[model samples]
Target: MKASTISLIIHGVDVDVVYKKVKYLRIGVYPPLGQVRVSAPTRFGHEQVRLAVIERLPWILRQREHFQTVERQSRREMVSGESHVVFGAAHRLQVIEQPGRERVEADADHLLLFVQAGSTPEHRLALLERWLREQLRQAVIALIAVWEQRLQVTVPQWTIRQMKTRWGSCNPQTRRISFNSELARKPPHCLEYIVVHEMAHYFHDGHGDGFTGFMDSHLPDWRSQRRELNKR
Candidate 1:
């Protein structure tokens, strides 16, 4: 019997199922988890593949729900009582009202945020974000110096900015690395791992076996730090 392909709409999203060679039916979704792809062997017809995907539909819905929950949780916009990351540690800001200038200072524990007596919450948040970025810049430079020596690589330029998704990115062609400014709020090891990861890219452009080997040899805990960074 000749196998056929089919397409169907699941949860208002279109999914295409294909029949290929030498494989049992398999279903998986991409990052946002709203769509599923089904692949099956030539011996199996599209109907069978569709049924398998239908069976797994509940699991897919659960995965999508989980993704949405996490996404909502990760979008912290710097409000009072909202947690901010510093050196990978979660710190809640203590918003203090002041009579004059807006200022930010850190004590042995929490970040002390002071704003002009009449200043609004928005102003205070902006001031704090600026201070955080400055701290991040200093820390990034320090980490770069350490890794340049440790990895025996030279990075010509680097920038720290707030990135919505990725913690860091590197341009191997230009020897420039850009790190998410929010990293300053995370743990020190997280910063180090990101710096090292970008530095490693200076040597290996792709995340292949060579890249993994290089990272493993240089920083054995790199994987753990990466996991922790993402978990937050």
Candidate 2:
């Protein structure tokens, strides 16, 4: 069954509630404007959802405030025993001292970060970002190739960026797609979804009926992928 959505204003906050066949209620505060969304089971009505929103109003406002406070940044410290996500897996960071070369290697359950002695946080962060970019690049290239043949379309170009508001974007005129470098931190399948989502824009620009239809035909569970991408 198709989901139905309704809008509600709770304690001066606008919330979009979607009723679906899920077993529980989930509320998320999204970025760019801290938009709040709630997924309630089909059995729940406006009052139930509204009460849930009311209970979480304080948390919702705090999330909104957090988004307002920080646009985007790679805030991880270059230290050992820290948590870092690479390709959707939680890897323990193991910092090792080396000279002249800063590199990162992902093992079974740990990320081996080799850096020069006394390397600053910024230095190590830059090194890690570079590594993530390369990883994202390789994955996106393969995804683009697969989707290109599957969709029977050609992409002019694609690049990775540290985007603050979007996972991916496409220019229909240029046939160029830009993926967020942050995709490296998410699941591999999320990267595939972004590639397909951007490439689909070649046929449909805005997310209207045509765009939704195209996405549904190609990636039937795109909505779930999108939800996972936006999980808080």
Candidate 3:
């Protein structure tokens, strides 16, 4: 069956409406900007979909508020002696300036960033981002190895990159995953849940009953992990 798309504005909120061959209506609020999306049966008219959105107005607003809170807490300022998160632990960043190769080392409580002398803030931030990507890489590699054995599916490739909203995404078609580098700043368990969630897509493509069942059976604590991960 073919699908159609349309835009909507309810109570000053922008929504994306998708009409498809579905049994019922479904609404979702995505991260980054709390994008509102509605999926409805093609049989439903525009007014019917609008009424459904109106009925769920309060719930939609609440979800948007939650997204805003998470965003504010995730903001980072790359500087010395600033608090940074790695592997779910808080570490103070110690920026060291010297005429040496730029590198980063981490101990229990500190991230020692050795940078070339007289580096700009942008340069420092870029170096830190690169380091964070590497950190996420190592962690993801270890987690994927364990999950591949348990789930019995191999991931061909994965990349760590900055994402505005999602923690991770899977392109099952390509057998590749894109992980949010910011996960390095979140709790370790939270990162684990994201990895598992994305890998589950190898079997289930959407957040439907099948996907939920897959997650519940494999990572029973995923719901709690998601709640904690969304907390400010």
Q: How well is each residue in 30-50 modelled by candidate 1, as lDDT tens digits?
A: 433244556677777556766
| Residue 194 displacement in candidate 2 (angstroms) | 0.9
* Per-model CA lDDT versus the true structure: 0.72, 0.83, 0.85
In terms of lDDT, the poorest run of 10 residues in model 1 is: 28-37
TM-score, prediction 2 = 0.73
lDDT order of candidates, best first? 3, 2, 1
Model 2 spans > 4 angstroms off: 1-29, 32-64, 68-74
Best by lDDT: 3
* Error at 15, model 1, angstroms: 18
Candidate 3 stretches greater than 4 Å from native: 1-77
Which RMSD values do the candidates have, in order? Answer: 7.9, 6.7, 5.2
lDDT of 3 by residue, 1-232 (tens): 4566677888788888887779999999886547688999989999999899999999999998888787777656667878887867889999899886998899999999998887887788788878888888888999999999999999998998867556788887997899988788788899999999999989986566677889999999999998887555
Greater lDDT among 1 and 3 belongs to: 3
